[model samples]
Target: MGAGIVGLATAWQLQRDGFDVTVIDAHRPGQGASFGNGAQLSYAYVQPLADPSIWAQLPKLLLSRESPFSLRLRLDPAQWAWGLRFLAACRAEVSARSTGTLLALAEESREVLQQLLADTQAHCDFTTSGKLVMYGSEASFAAARHQLDLQRALGGAEQHALSLADCLRVEPALAGSAARYVGGIHTPGECAADCARLCDALHGALQARGVRFVLGAPLGALRREGDRLVAVQAGNDWIEADGFVAALGTGVTAFARRLGVSLPVYPLKGYSLTLDAPVGSGLAPNVSVTDAQRKLVFARLGQRLRVAGLAELAGHDTRIETRRVEQLRRAAREVFPLACAGTETRPWAGLRPATPTGVPIVGRVGGAPANVLFNAGHGALGFTLAAGSARRLSRQLQGVAERPRTAAALIRSAARPAENSA
Candidate 1:
């Protein structure tokens, strides 16, 4: 039980499906990882973090001062277990398979998001301004082009390898740093928005739909009746429901473990900075931009610019590392110096509940109660894939007969709550 974007999204979907639902979270809605993110609906590029190229960059990732990815080499058992699985999933075949599955879910998510926005009539500064993945090296560009070819093979459209001239034509704001990048892969169907605003709107909509919210309510003991959830112990109060869904981000790991389930979800910390975009300034990005080498994403959110990146595998610490924050600041200044908005920028850091395969664990926990489900571990694409993941789970819980056959097959193993339990 949570009130993050994933939790709120799932509750909304369930409410729409005519289910009585209640959301419980220790913090206010969207105050966790959903609060600050890259702010891009990156649906087309579903590349997992465990790419084959990561093995090649292990040295730089471990030693470089300015490397966007880092591992602190923890002595924690969960970290080691997750790290081993992460290494194993770094093969080419695994990466390709994960990408395919993630893209399918992401595509569905984009559609579901659009439908939800239309149905709820909520405002979140949502915009479909397209996306540009700018590359700094020829090797990286070639690799990305190869990815484009794979997407094409998988029936993906509206994605193309853009020339330098074409990149400038699409997002003229990058002209100032034209010499910094080689080329870009453009996806005109991608979207961007403020995730916090979406969460706030979703919360309001759910309330209007008669859904109950118990904010600042930390989950304690979970009571079960013969492998079926009976009630949730929340700060001395027992809240009973027919079913329960855990969307508590990294907290899901411990909660699941209490029920004898092993979740591979680990926290990967990321940073973001939001600053006002100068009016009439040609320096602000019109389309969302991703710097290939730095692994940072820049999106224009209404009058503000959101720049986010860096993945730190350093446990669940949410402290904002000034060094990392400075790194983002310098990158913003270097790329769009004139649009900085000085020191008035809002800096934030959050732990993304990441998985080795990058495919989220949006299913039921084995050995847990029959009615308990999980919708956590979305890694970096939580907001991007939340709606579709929630919709699928809602249908599964509702025992819908018209569910997509293909999706059913894909999630059969995951849909079973007792898959590995006795």
Candidate 2:
């Protein structure tokens, strides 16, 4: 059980669809990955990391402890099995299909997020400033250009390559290091939000809507009858629901197995750091930025800067490795040196529930306890796609025919030119 963004969003959507919803979590709402992410509501990103070229580079990444990607070899045998499946999905064709699926979900997610904010009259430092991805090397930039073409072919939104000067003009904070980047792509329609604050507001709204939140309660086990879920046991008490949603991130696998359901979800650990910006720093980045080489991402929330990266397969160990933190700081300094000065830094680690094909298992878990639905395995795109996936889940549970534009279809559409823009 989790009270993270996806969980809360799922509860909210269910309530809207006339369901009596109760949410339970092992921690306070939004205290997990949703609280400490880069806070990028990125709709432009549709590509999954299991690209075709990754198989060749896995050994190098695994051997280098300080590399952006890591795998804790001793954790869980299931993690290794998941990693192998992830590698299998790295074929070019597979990656394309996965990208298409995610893009569809992400696009719908953006719309759902906007509607939720508007309906609740909630604000969480939200902005439409969009996202910018810069390339440091010419080769990398060239590759990005090629990928953008594929993105366009896959129904991606309107995007333009920016020259060094234009990129600096769009984001004055990057002027000093303009030379380091050969070029950049700007998704002017994408948006960003203070993820922690958004979750807080959503939790409040859900409470007002009569949704119950059981916090800091660990799930003991599931009480099941023949082909049906009776209730969930937590500690000494049992809580029953008319329906159950498994949005428990990495915790889904074991729970699913107990219920005789097959879930391909596994944990992909990622690290992040938040730094307080100096007064009058003039170093604000309105748009979120992702660096390909270092796998680093930068997003601004008022005066605080969030820098997150490094996907380590460390098997549920939420320990913060100093080396990884240092790498994140180094990347931030390289890109925005002035922003890191005189700032107190806090490091964080979150397990992204990732699936091999990158698409979340959103449909009902057939042959399981009745009314059990899954909305997990989102990986890094949880924040980016939570609202949309929640909306999709709600429609499905209500037996309402989803609009023709489903999440999977939208991703394919977004990869193409027509639906690419916000």
Model 1, position 4, has a per-residue lDDT of 85
How many clashes would you count in candidate 1? 0
Count clashes in each candidate, considering only residues at least 3 apart in sequence or on different chains.
0, 13
Worst 10 residues of 1 by lDDT: 413-422
Measured with C-alpha atoms, the lDDT of residue 200 in candidate 1 is 92
Specify the highest-lDDT model's number. 1
Lowest summed lDDT across 10 adjacent residues in model 2 is found at 413-422
Query: In candidate 2, which residue ranges exceed 4 Å CA deviation?
Result: 279-282, 401-422
lDDT of each: 0.83, 0.77
Q: How well is each residue in 29-70 modelled by candidate 2, as lDDT tens digits?
A: 888778788788878776788787686667878787657888
Q: Give the alpha carbon lDDT tens digit for every residue of 144-241 in model 1.
A: 99888887776665798999999999988888888999899999989998998988999999998899888877998888888788899877678999
| Candidate 2: residue 238 lDDT (0-100) | 84
